[model samples]
Target: MKIPIRSECLPYALILSFLSIIFYFLNKYIAILMLILLAFVLFFFRDPERTIPFDEKSFLSPADGKVIDICEIEENEFFKSKAIKVSIFLSLFNIHVNRSPISGKVTYKKYRPGKYLPAFKSHASEINEKNIIGIENEYTKVLVSQITGFVARRIVCWSKIGDTLKQGERFGLIKFGSCTEIIMPIDTEIKVKIGDTVKGGLTVIGVIK
Candidate 1:
């Protein structure tokens, strides 16, 4: 059986290959090292997984990885007040696609250019290059943040200012590996924890309202 790696590094691959040919005439060892690093980058950004199934009751995971944080964090955006935050960290080996956790309309969408930090760090959520999508449901508004990790340089988001989305829909893809955070209202109860492993679209991280 053949396994597939869903990474968008074809451009980098071509660029590296071209540079390798030029560097080969100057130094064979340096050229070989560059080739290896390029290969590692391509493999690290691999994306392999199915889209999370749609279910209103189940709050799906945004990225494929382990749940690192499921606590209350001070929300700065839509819910200017306090909120329960469920954070998922995606390593280089995990799938990089981001999916919607619930069905709702996007009330706010903003991309901030920031420094690239390790996804596992708590402060990285606020300082890393990220895309924030605020959604509103019948109960309350929820915000999903896609934070870029050290190696994951590109953050892709498909949500618009006034678009309606269904639960588990593919709204974005975090290039390479990163972290995803779901912020719920202060009154919302969190279901997952700091060390629990969660699968996107299947795990119930929290309930509505």
Candidate 2:
């Protein structure tokens, strides 16, 4: 069976595999190291299929990770009002692909270049290099931020403004370890809490109330 890897892995996989072959003739240790790295690259970019729940009233988690923080904050980017922000921290072992939390039209997309800090830090959400995507439907609007961590330097987003997406649809991914935050209206009923493990496109983050 073909491995379910993201298209983004092609470049990395090819480069690493080529280097491994070239170095094998010169140094076995170096070639073995390259092979190990190649395996990790393939593993990290794996995009397994998910069973998306068909629920119009619930919003799914945007990425796979642990919920690090959740708080009410003044959101001026999309909601322009009080919003509840749920932050998820992706470790090296977690899947980095981001998914649409709700079935909606992509209304807003912005990329801000900034510092690469540790994603677990509370302040990292404000200063880290990030891509912000807003999706809205007839019921409500939601914002997902893909933030780059110290080791995660690239944030990939395939979604564009005006694009329509279904709940749990793959929108983009963050290379390596990073952070993802979902900001919803204050009235949203949150379903998960801090330290809760969530799977992208599978775990419900909130319910529209």
Candidate 3:
């Protein structure tokens, strides 16, 4: 059991636990409270412990949640244009680790510090705390934005702007609960529909054009 616990955490479990303990002892009462909060954060941000089974040949869902929306939006990244937007909403109980949807080189990565809105609200995409990752795959470009919800306070992204990523690779994690938006080329086919439940690194949400 202890082995499995350590395995799931990769190399960060000990560090996280050690910090949690130190924090707990420094402010016993507050630290105890934070430890409980940390436990919930660990649980919610937990990454699934299985291979997605898809080779670098297929596109995968970047998040584990429900597809709340699919729309067209004005992309302000490079060209300052419009693109098809696919939004996935992560609830407090949903896993918050985000994966790369397709193999590509990250072209743009920016973080916007903003307000924490309810993930279910329509304005959350624009007004909420979020981090955006734009990738260029061959001839196609896509944007994946991690948006924070009311209960979410932290967003973690591991990939740099010039780093290369394979399909379904773990690229980032959002603490607590939040939402993510994937913007694809206008011609890209959306494989998942609104209300469909998706799992990170496992479910197919779209394909590169």
Candidate 4:
């Protein structure tokens, strides 16, 4: 099995492990606890390679988490029309990385600073601080938003406007705990539902007819 740890967490894990080593000289019990926490921090950021579906008509999930909601909304920012929004809520245990759902050129990218509401709340999608990426292919434009939660303070995006992204390619991640959203055209067929478990890059979220 190929275990790919996201490079972003190395500095954090190393720092915590180093502190644990120092704490060992002061108190063995505290040192042991810190070591255990370090292990979890490393695990939280683990980005394993997945067998993504090779389908040109399918849209994949952007983050590893549970499908908290599926709703229809007027997405005024990008689509400027009706769209089906699939929201995934990530806990501390879920992988924080985000991926591209389709192979397309990034046509729009925007970062909005706002409140850090709990990601589980449906309104977090609109009100929370977020990084929005819109990818466009010949058929349609898809928007993926990475939003901050109560605890998550950082949103990292690697793809910029005009960048070409292959399906299931890594684009960015939300630090600690957050939410990811994939907004597709209203007429698209959704493959997943509320409460369904999903894995980033591997799970198919919707299909274009």
Q: All candidates' lDDT scores?
A: 0.79, 0.95, 0.78, 0.92
* Candidate 4 backbone overlaps, count: 0
Scanning candidate 3 in windows of ten residues, the lowest lDDT window is 1-10
Query: For every model in order, what is the number of clashing pairs?
Result: 0, 0, 0, 0
| Candidate 2: tens digits of C-alpha lDDT, residues 89-157 | 999999999999999999999999999999999899889999999999999989999999999999999
- 130-209: candidate 4 lDDT, tens digit per residue: 99999999977799999999999999999999999988999999998999999999999999989999998899999998
| TM-score for all models, in order of appearance | 0.80, 0.98, 0.79, 0.96
- Measured on C-alpha atoms, candidate 1 has an lDDT of 0.79
lDDT of 3: 0.78
lDDT, ranked from best to worst: 2, 4, 1, 3
> Model 3, which residues run further than 4 Å from truth?
1-42, 55-58
Alpha-carbon RMSD to native, per candidate: 3.0, 1.0, 4.5, 1.2
Best by TM-score: 2
- Candidate 3's TM-score: 0.79
Cα lDDT, model 3, residue 177:
73
Considering only N, C-alpha and C atoms within 3 Å, which residue pairs clash in candidate 3?
A: none
- lDDT, residue 46, candidate 2: 91
Ten-residue segment with the worst summed lDDT in candidate 2? 1-10
